[model samples]
Target chain A: MSAAGGSNPEYVIARVRARRSALFGDEEYRKLVRMGPAEIARFMEESEYEAEINALGSRYSGVDLIEYGLNHNMAKQFNDILDWADGRLYDLIARYLRKFDAWNVKTIIRGIYSETPRDEIETDLIRAGEFDDRLISRLLDAAEIEEVVELLSGTIFADGLEAAYDDYEDVGVLVPLENAVDRAFYEQLLDGLVVGEETKQYREFLEAEIDFRNARNALRIARSGADLDPTDYFIEGGTLFRAAELAALATNPDELVSKIRDSRYGDRLSNALSDLEEADSLIGFERALDAALLEYADTLGYVFPLSVTPIISYILAKEREVDNIRAIARGREAGLPPEEIEEELVIQ
Target chain B: MIEAIEPLMTALQSEAASGPAISPSAAAALAVGLAAFGAGYAERGIGSAAMGAIAEDEDLFVNGLILTVLPETLVILALVVVFLV
Candidate 1:
């Protein structure tokens, strides 16, 4: 159980595999999309989400109950992984789970800046990250945005927030602070990672995610024809596009599409790229990216069944399930037709 | 001092020549020991995975037990080398 001991990928992978199979398939999604919010809640209770649904059932009903249950279950599941992992596995996972830390921080900052109630903000905070209950409570208790930033002084966000705080004072917008937090998370993601063969593959997977994100941002900027510089949105460490290249490509959607099609991800993303060209919609392109990333992770898992890949694969699949369920619930609540809701899903 | 050391050296040499450092039976025992170690190493992963599966679902108990013991065949194969030796 000590950090010095070897990783227990075997045990984690077994549990992960079991959970992966429990995720909703196409049939479940079809049924869920056709069902009303109450029916969806009922359906969830009969499945893997039974406990969360039942626990939240009394307080809230319909979509709110479903959403809260999903968030709570997601946090619990991810936290359990961190609890079960030890040694380097824990370190690797904690690094990734820090995304939720960033999520919580941004939510609190926004809540304070907008004068949202503390209890209302609390419901939005996902407890999946390395941040313990004490830290989260402190953040929630902070009355001002500055106090929230000061509370994060010892964290990875400290330096980034310190720099961004100046920009916030000058511009009076939350964008700079949010970007700084994101940059901090992405920067720490691959920092000083000692690359073994499998870890190198993992690194590549992460880089691909960064690349796709950058590409999506570029595409959106190009589509919008905004006067804002694309370089501001450029995330470092992606191998696909340099900052200067992105600035140029962001003005030309065709060139951006061609560039992505010519890269190493071209084969896997060919269909998505073509869809982007034909459909000319950001949502479809984003869904395609999600599906492609999910497929890539699944392949990586099978290729190296005994490494962190399987766990990562499971994590991605679980996140997708949660997203799909959320989308279905929200879409149904909005009275969107089932066919349109199906389009919103990124199911494989 | 030289006279005392000379007799002790000869006695030690005579004792060394009386038997081999490691007998064949001892080597065979070493082989079984190493084989058992290999089996245990293999079982470590399978056993953990089986336990995880069993913990998830009660129906998997039998399956988990079977997979957990699959690595025992390595020790069994190593035992044949014991008989041959």
Candidate 2:
């Protein structure tokens, strides 16, 4: 309990595990998919999101209420993680949490590029990263993408963003800058950790994540038959696809699936891969990847009980809950059928 | 090197005649104190983990308290050495 006693993983994990248990079960999602937007909000108010839903209810309604509640709960859960962690534990958890920074930066740049209002952009940011309020406010206040990049001057994202700004100019597209930010985030994710037995396993887990992301990107490119270069979207650090291999494999769906089937992730993704072969729906396959990641994270939690893996696993589950709730609310608002909406929810 | 402490044998004779400044009972008591220190050190991690669980659920307080004191069994066993001595 003493602040001076340093990191309390036990307390954090205990609370996290309790919160993890409270996430919406599969049955809840099934019931939620059948409800309307107002009904979804009502359901949320009775769950772990009650505080967030009540707090944001005055300003937003229906799907917006669900969206704000989801984002707020996401921020609160992650911020609690950072607050609980200390020493090297803080360092490890914060590394993964930088995804929010990537998300915030991309949102801001896209908003500024499209001239969306600052207030709207600010609402979307999950303030759970290493970035403080001052930095985020500065980013919001910036009138242009250049100014936004300049505002982030000394952060890890600065250099890559600055470089991508040129590519953004040449093509007049936001893809370059977004890719730069994503590349920076993943690059720094596993950078400079002390090598040990447990960390080695953690490293492999991260690499698997990167590999899955690359596969998703490649599959989308191949399926969409986009004229854009697949290599450009290829993120480094994944063991599955080298950058050059993406270009050739991206043109042929059968070869791409075969290559993935032979790779390290083959075992974890066999069912999803088979589904892709049968149904030819990349969306379902992507959802399968997400389920596989969730299951893998759960396994990692039990293997390294007191390590960073459980903490990350909890984060994933919480994020999934928020996403599922939002999907139900949005699906209801959009008048999508219950069964279709239920398909969108990744319950596993 | 294997001469087996002739100087300490002579010192012991002289020292024992002076009725030994530190008795075996005192030595055993010191052992108990060190064992208690070891028990306290072991309790540190368990105690923190217990408090953590208790904080999440009030119902766990009793269980946490029980687990926290489990290491005290070491010190209790160390007490047996005092009686033996």
Report the number of the highest-DockQ candidate. 1
- Compared with the true structure, what per-residue lDDT tens digits does model 1 show for residues A1-348? 224554377787788888888888988988889999999999999988899999989999999999999999999999988887777777777777888999999999999989999999999989999999999999999998889889999999999999999999999999999988988887788777767766777788888888988998899899988798999888888899999999999999999999999999899889888888898878878877888788777787776777677778778888888899999999999999999999888786
The Cα error of candidate 2 at residue A283, in Å, is: 1.3
Q: lDDT: which candidate is best?
A: 1
Model 2 lDDT tens row, A24-97: 88888888888988888888899888999999999999888888888988898899889888777788789889
Window of ten residues with lowest summed lDDT in model 1 chain A: A1-10
Best by TM-score: 1
- TM-score, cand. 1: 0.91
After superposing candidate 2 on the true structure, give the runs of residues whose Cα lies further than 4 Å from its correct spot: A1-7, B1-23
Error of 2 at B68 (Å): 2.4
lDDT of 1 at A51: 96
lDDT (Cα atoms) of all candidates against the true structure: 0.86, 0.84
